[model samples]
Target: MGRQYAVIGTGAIGGFYGACLQKAGLDVHFLLRRDYDYVKEHGLAISSTFGDFTLPQVNAYNQVENMPPCDVVLIALKTTQNHLLPHLLPPLLKPGTVVITLQNGLGVEPEIATIVGETAQVLGGLCFVCSNKIGLGQIHHLDYGQIQLGAYGNNHQPQGITPTMRQIAADFEQANIPIQLAENLLLARWKKLVWNIPYNGLSVVLDATTDAMMKDSYGYQLSEQLMREVIAGAAGYGLEIKESFIQKMLDYTMKMKPYRTSMKIDYDCHRPLEVEAMFGNPMRAAQAVGVAVPQITMLYQQLKFLDARNIAIGN
Candidate 1:
């Protein structure tokens, strides 16, 4: 049989990619939360700049135990909901199941290892897609759907490109999704953070879209500064991200569609911002290595306060 797949947390990221994998004629199951009933009745819809398609029917489940054990499990849940993993993972896992975490932030893979143990292999998938859940059972893919994947050892060290990594890459490539295999997982996370930190943080704090941020003078300069701080922090942690990446990401963002960040969207929807995963962990990592990132530290402090205030006020 072909690879059996399970997608937990079928929101924007999970729903979009899981739909793509299913469209590839693979046997894919989606374990949904809020959108479960709607998707179960009407199926999932993806509106993408590349093209638009709708699946009339999908193997959808409301609970993890209702799904069968699968060969690959794609976790697309928010890091905030990760406390449920110890309870959620046991039902859908089996021997030789490869768990791929498609969540944001650092230090995620090791956390999965602690729960899944040696029975299942875990990988980190850093998605560069900009998409959102516009409604129940709907995903809007704006631009960029490339994924960078890395292998994680039991101790969470980078194991370089392995056979399983290559196979998964081929599988994604077959589905017409761009895939990059990273020999170093930490470095890949740091590189993605170079873009995420500035864009996600500023979009919420300044209340602007990415294009608007790039167009304005203060926004442009501060974003550049934050990018530089990310580079410094990574280097201090012995994961040296190149200085050239800043300009590369800047140029890319300048040409992209005028878009709101995920964090900004979460804030608008009253969902809790991933303050700890995106900022807290990185700031603490830098401090552990005696690296001072004043700009990032300030952003972290501001975002933490804002997040707390939003949560306290029920928004």
Candidate 2:
């Protein structure tokens, strides 16, 4: 009778965190896709730098319609699969269901808001984790596992940190995952782009890991320029991204392990990249405010071509 939790999209992000929540003794149900049968029989395995564990038997299902309504729903699906939400969310939501999206990029909470309407309290969560599903029902957590939480209001306005946000944060804290609340979801999205725009783009375009980008002089400089463009874009939207944050992110990356970005991995696997949500929208937002982002625009155009080709090949 603890919080009834449901995890939609049980891939790397969802699988890792959902396993953590379930291990913490919550009534967590996993709505899996391709790995549903494997996980249901063999359980989910997590290999983490902090620790390693496995759930011997998880409440697993393959369809939303079969899952019971839950008090909390963690949406960890890629934005590319968001079109399924209007059909996927209704059966899993009750009167006070709290929906938290752990996906990247901007404008996600607003999109979910439109689907769930007033029945659920939707929130945005930025997960700072380097983890991937290395095999069927297995997640390898390489490094970093902090979460930044923010409340989403009507029309996607920033509602600051509410008591419900605190309650969710407390739940995560009990599970040993660090969580921080952001005052504004939009500003938080912009801040995360300070690191994501550079590494996620360059990693795919240049075919390099994060350390490789940081070690090479040219790649390092281009990364800095991309960061500056993001800062300028944020400023154009009236969100001041301080100059020091660039160096702070650089230093942080320099200290972490050499990592392949999500987009880079998607490209390697021939899955669709999140170019529109991550790069295209930000570029358009900047241009609307009369700010020029030549570097970001270039990156968006290149990624657009690459993504389209991937889709074509898939077809």
Candidate 1: segments with Cα more than 4 A from true spot: 154-156
For residue 94, give model 2's deviation from the true position in Å: 1.2
Against the reference, the lDDT scores of all candidates come to 0.90, 0.91
**Per-residue lDDT for 59-145 in model 1, tens only?**
999989899999899999999899999999988889999999999988789899899998899999999998998999999998889
Which candidate's TM-score is highest? 2
List TM-scores for all candidates, in order: 0.96, 0.97
Best by lDDT: 2
Q: Candidate 2: where are CA atoms >4 Å away?
A: none
Q: lDDT per residue, candidate 2, 112-205, as tens digits?
A: 9898998999999999998999999999999889999999987457798899999999889888999999988889999999999999999888
